[model samples]
Target: MASTLRFSVTFLTLLFSLWVVEVHTSRKLISIKEEEDQTISHLLKDGEFDDPSLYMFFRINDLKYDLKSGSKLPIFFNKDDPQKLPPLITRQEADLIPFTTSKLDFLLSHFSISKDSPQGKAMKETLERCNYKPMEGQLKFCGTSLESMLDLVKETIGSNADLKVMTTKVTVPTQNTVSYALHNYTFVEAPKELFGVKMLGCHRMPYPYAVYYCHGHKSGSRVFEVNLVSDNGRQRVVGPAVCHMDTSMWNTDHVAFKVLKIEPGTAPVCHFFPLDNIVWLTK
Candidate 1:
């Protein structure tokens, strides 16, 4: 009787162990699915261009905090005239008027006169004497011109003690083979510790025979797709089997490879062949 009891207990323990493993596996699969969903959400929210073929574009760069806050001057210009312009105040500007009321109100009240009025003509003459160009066509905010905004902001911020702003220029290749600006903006603080803040407007492309490094926590499946499809002939090696090999074999050979804790999702996989075998495949 005692022997029979022992056998039953052993069988129950084995069954319990199997159940635990199965549950753990299922939970891992759920977690992976959640992560994939979050990635897709981010891409949808931040991507502005409508190129369906593009996998992803860099996020828009904006002025950083270090830069002198551009005179958030509220200004307007005549749509038809193109030159004669005036400033329109926003709610934020109105609230701020109390703090800098004397200077702001003086500028605004003087700007109220029409260009054809005597006082307006006198004011225009005075501005011209002071090197202020009567902005024709529109009464727009006449702080610094947009063309020089980036540079002016950089210089202004760099002058201050607390802030340091630098600019990096990256050239991106267009489909027509011409290179165009990818990012240009003043940054307050570095976005990433290693990589300074950037304003990007280019798409990421995959290169042939190159392995992309990915972190263990959130795998870059979309990035992998971009890399795989970059070469027209290399598209076939990107599905389930290849993804597995990329995560396992190819990663091991490259110095960039880092071990990832994969749950129930597919592993990025790669296969490497000897030089002779590679020649055979190419032939």
Candidate 2:
């Protein structure tokens, strides 16, 4: 009977040890995940530019819409080869799989992402945003392929119109956020043109394949080639800035209002485009 009692105690002790190890392991994993998230947050800091709040006093002009919202979309730039962008996939290839929550299981399986994984959650959010309706005077479309995006741009601006594509050029290699000043602004396509610079802002979405959330803002928007220099004078990036003249349709609580110290619909809101974003200007 004493031997039996000893065996029971031994079993209980073994189970307790296992439970303690499991808890410790779980906590360690959580800590590692939190640290990773914080790192990404630093990389994706607001406005995609350094010290965006200072934009109000720096180089304020007829530039258009603010892209400095708190969206975790993506912060990384294209692999320095903006010209050789993701190729055009077939229409059937893009249409075969839908980006919808109802097909979450299928979509996750197609992308080889576990439903409970962080990537799966990101894909879900992208799907939801794509499905949402466009804002007032806003033209929104999700292009699964580069061809589709270009086609939409030509349709909106005009098939016969000449075009110029501009992307944010990042010179720094480190992951740290660096401050930059707008040295000067040059209009690639002015708002006063006949087509009024039919601008299309295409932002890259997180996906197995290249997906872009392309939207064209209404008139009263201007596209500019902004010359930026880092505060340390170590990095220089010639990026595109879009300014929205019509803020009446913008949300009252947009970050631009707070940064500029003005209410929405009162003044123009303009922000520098991120590294991966594409700004299409029609000539």
Candidate 3:
């Protein structure tokens, strides 16, 4: 009887120790997340983007963040705009209509585009980029449709994941093109750390229809959600920003370096995703 009682006590002690260790780990993760949040908040508030091109980026309507629970974020342009969004097709459809060199002439004719035109060049470039091999530590895929984009996201973060999609939302119309100097902005929602969050960033590619180039990094990067009120209370933006922790692989003459006045790898480079870009995160 005494031996059994002792064994029970020992088992209870081991379980208690495990529980304590789990609690400690949880607290540590929370602390790290808090620290990351503070860091991102500081960068958003203090980082300078004096160049008009850089400053006006926040005004772009397509890059706004949408955190609201929904079935999924649509790939269309802002409803306020008159031009209707291009029809979104599926991967199978895209493959059949394949935008390839062999069909370049056919594509241009169908889209009413000239081979020598800028849009034509962009289309060709997009095709090339989509086919190009991804760099080390990067996973890339060009999504020709909403379903295709979601497929990539699911592949990256798992199909059962609780997913969140963010795009830039424009709050002020006139202020969209205005400079940052003319604005006084505040963070509507404090920056949140996305540690251990799986992410897929989708960049809108120029096409007759919607084409998204989605990519994810392996490491040395962080993502955050930011809300900004700019243009002296006129322009407000809810957006997602990514901070690249390692810029060592980046070109020395990268624009971020010129704007931030820091060389590659010297410091972390963070920038707001362009209007029309999407950042998918798993909750």
Top TM-score: which candidate number? Answer: 3
Give per-residue CA lDDT, model 1, range 172-201, as digits (tens): 233322111111122222222212211111
The estimated TM-scores of all candidates read 0.17, 0.59, 0.63
Ranking by lDDT: 3, 2, 1
CA lDDT, candidate 3, residue 206: 76
lDDT of each: 0.23, 0.56, 0.58
Q: What TM-score does model 1 achieve against the real structure?
A: 0.17
- Candidate 2 lDDT at 216 equals 74
| C-alpha lDDT of candidate 2 relative to the true structure | 0.56
- Select the stronger candidate by lDDT from 1 and 2: 2
Each model's number of backbone clashes? 32, 6, 10
Tens-digit lDDT string for candidate 3 (141-228): 8888766677777787666535666666545575245222323345555567678877788877778888889887777778877666
| lDDT, residue 48, candidate 3 | 44
Question: Per-residue lDDT tens digits of candidate 2, residues 1-283?
Answer: 6755664465455334322311110101000122333322322234444542234321233333122321121112222233334444666788787867789889898868998888888888888878889897787888786667767777876664365666676554565443232322223222232245678888877666778898877667766665543433455566666777778887787767665566777777766665556777775
User: Candidate 2: where is the Cα deviation over 4 Å?
Assistant: 1-92, 171-195, 253-262
User: How do these models rank on TM-score, best leading?
Assistant: 3, 2, 1
